[model samples]
Target: MTKNIKANGLNHLAISTNNMKEQIEFYTDVLGFRLVALYWMHGVEGCWHGFLEMNDSSQVAFVFNPANKDAKVEYGVTNPGHTGGPSAPGTMQHLAFNVDTLDDLLNMRDRIRSRGYNVMGPMDHGMCHSIYFQGPEDTCLEVATFGNADYPIGPKDWIDPEVQELAGISDEELAKFTNPIEFEGQGGTIPNPGYNPDSYNPDRPVQLLQGMFAMPDEQFAMIPMEKRPPSMMSDEDRAAKHAN
Candidate 1:
């Protein structure tokens, strides 16, 4: 028997920031996002974290550290600078936020322009209409709304066989990609497969990876999650101190 599980929506997108205050102002004043959280990161030393409310559950978080301030920003490596530009392989090229309606998207564009930032367009992409703009630190931003909410957009309408072949994906692979294999509940019966370099590639040292893999799941989980630094402030205290 197989079990069905999937992510519902994005909870948050954490972006590394050099200046927490500047990013906070840009996100709150220019983009109309409400500042929700600002405090020292729980586990990391000298690291400040800020969160802006996108919705009740989701937020856009910022992390600032002294080291991050000194880090150099290479246009094509650190950021794309503009929408449709190139960035490093693993780096975020651009971020797009969703709007409920086309009118809302246009209103966002107007609001951004009012904040003295130039916006690109409400361009139609067949499935959605988007307006592009720039954010602080060369961050490419976009707000979009679906062209037709009544119509369901599926892979059939968007996936092209030619592009699929160009990506070296066979028919069988494409089928599996579209419809993923279901996982059956194992009731914690399955053991760790152990470190196989071919199966898992991590940037960490071999010794570190092996030791980490050998550690018990309970111990490993607490290393990152359960840490409460001495200087850590409660969410309530932090929010009250920086009341907006």
Candidate 2:
């Protein structure tokens, strides 16, 4: 009998960087991730590793190879003789994250700015507003907030055309439009494109944890539970636990 199979979600994403210290600073100080672990690997000369955890305990690892002494190497540069070598816009373009509120998104933008990094505005997407910044590793990152979850903004399709004409559509305005195809029953007069009326439901919360490295499933299975650190808990809960 197949044992009751419960699939666990993503544990973390790993990325190799030339400057580990900068990367750690960017993720921890600028992005608010907590540095959970750090260590050096044996038999791997000049290599170090660090792990960071988000508020939800989602983990990201950064591996540093100091032996690779090329400081000026940009992301797109590749070894000439190798075929299909590394490229800047390789398979992944960027990573996107969701925030709980518009204020949260703005606060993040401010935090990123405080680090002296240039960040793109809280641009409005059809269903969300986002801000973009480059991590210390030069990886493009985005933080977005679903318009429906915060603020008095209504769905995009529900907004009257006349109102749009009068107000002048901005990124903020566009981000307010929820996919009418997704959320249909909120009672605003948006035209439904034959979406399953009975099956229509509000969007559920989702967290996306993405990374550059892929580990073998067997290796993951071999990891002991005790070795895996507990996830990040809320400040109040953590204080209570410490008091106990």
Candidate 3:
């Protein structure tokens, strides 16, 4: 049987940084994100990791590998910055951060330009107003703002039925996708998937943290209930558990 799960919001997005210092400076100084934490990556040798907090739940994290110092990025492939293009499969194409208002989006455009970046558009993208720019490591970035859920940021007429048909979405399927049936939480333990990896789509992650995906079904179930990601643990509790 299929299970229903609800996710509140993004926790963070982690990306590899060729130059951690440059990434940190760009995000913290230029973009106005507060540097929350910088620490050695646990269990990894000669690596550094840090977080730039957008808010309590949202963050942009960077992982620096000194071992790959001389590696070259293939622009438009590995790195799709500079007015945006395409990236290799399994590579992150671009990242968009949310702003609260259209005024905020316009101000962000001015902010980017003031920093000497060739920023483009508060483009009217139907769903949101967005500004695009390039950042360190050829990372394509966008800032966007949308109206409240009750209001239509996009006109109903803007939705093209032909495109929907071309995408092979039937009216019923589209209805279901847009207005999904909400599932009430059981408020119990995470259920064992009881499935084989061979039957799963490798690209579709059932669960993820940062950029990492869920463990193998059997291995995931073996984890003690208290050690699960959702289980709350204090510093002392974690220390005691680790010492066990």
Candidate 4:
């Protein structure tokens, strides 16, 4: 049996940026994060650090090292231990936060744009609406809000302009709907713009054993057998099948 553990919440995430002052300004002035602490060490040589707080009390830290010399050094690089380099893809390129409403998200986008940074979207992602932009340190950042249904129920192949408009739908109206379909990929190929099935997999196998433990037997039985892999079956059946 796997032990159940609970995490209190995220404390903070630290990343290295080229320009500390501009990054701090972007996060505080544009994104609305509050600066909790700032540090500069004397003998540490070109090191500066700042901590920013989210509304939820979670924190993120930024570190600037001016004398590190390597231009390519950045957070999430293949050799992260190295002093300086560009961050590799699949690494931490950005951080995201959840917003309460689409209006709040758009307001943030406008604020960021007013600061002379290019802003993108209010894009629809089935379960959520999001806006993206680059921060002062060239770090990608996103602010999102739950808009449509709670989850993607089918292929994301029918994102219309109307859907984008619907993202700003009121909470009461959004509650009237159920099981929204999400567009796959990073908003799909052009012409269609936001339709990509490859972005989500609807057929991922279910773990029957874990389900049985987590839910009532009746609920487990109600799950489709085809969605359950053989390994999810009872130990008796697994042993019999393996013996054969």
Error of 4 at 88 (Å): 2.7
Ten contiguous residues with the weakest lDDT in model 4: 186-195
Q: Clash number for every model?
A: 0, 1, 0, 5
**What is the Cα-based lDDT of residue 69 in candidate 4?**
43
Report the CA-based lDDT of candidate 1 relative to the real structure. 0.82
Using lDDT as the measure, name the better of candidate 1 and candidate 3.
1
Angstrom error of the Cα, residue 159, model 4: value is 20
- Predicted model with the maximum TM-score: 1
- Model 3: worst 10 consecutive residues (lDDT sum): 208-217
For model 2, what is the alpha-carbon lDDT of residue 14? 73
Off by over 4 Å in 3: 1-5, 43-46, 66-71, 82-84, 147-151, 154-159, 199-244
- Better model by TM-score: candidate 2 vs candidate 4: 2
Writing each residue's lDDT as its tens digit, candidate 3 over 1-244 gives 5566678798888899878889988998678899887765654656768899999889999998886677678876777655557778778888998889887877888877888888888787666777888888778888888742234554254557899899999989888877789786676546545435565445545454312333454664575544233145567876765565
Off by over 4 Å in 2: 1-9, 41-46, 70-92, 147-244
Q: Which stretches in model 4 have alpha-carbon errors above 4 Å?
A: 1-4, 40-46, 73-90, 147-244
Model 2, 37-105: lDDT tens digits are 776533355566788887565788887887556655455552211122355443335666667878999
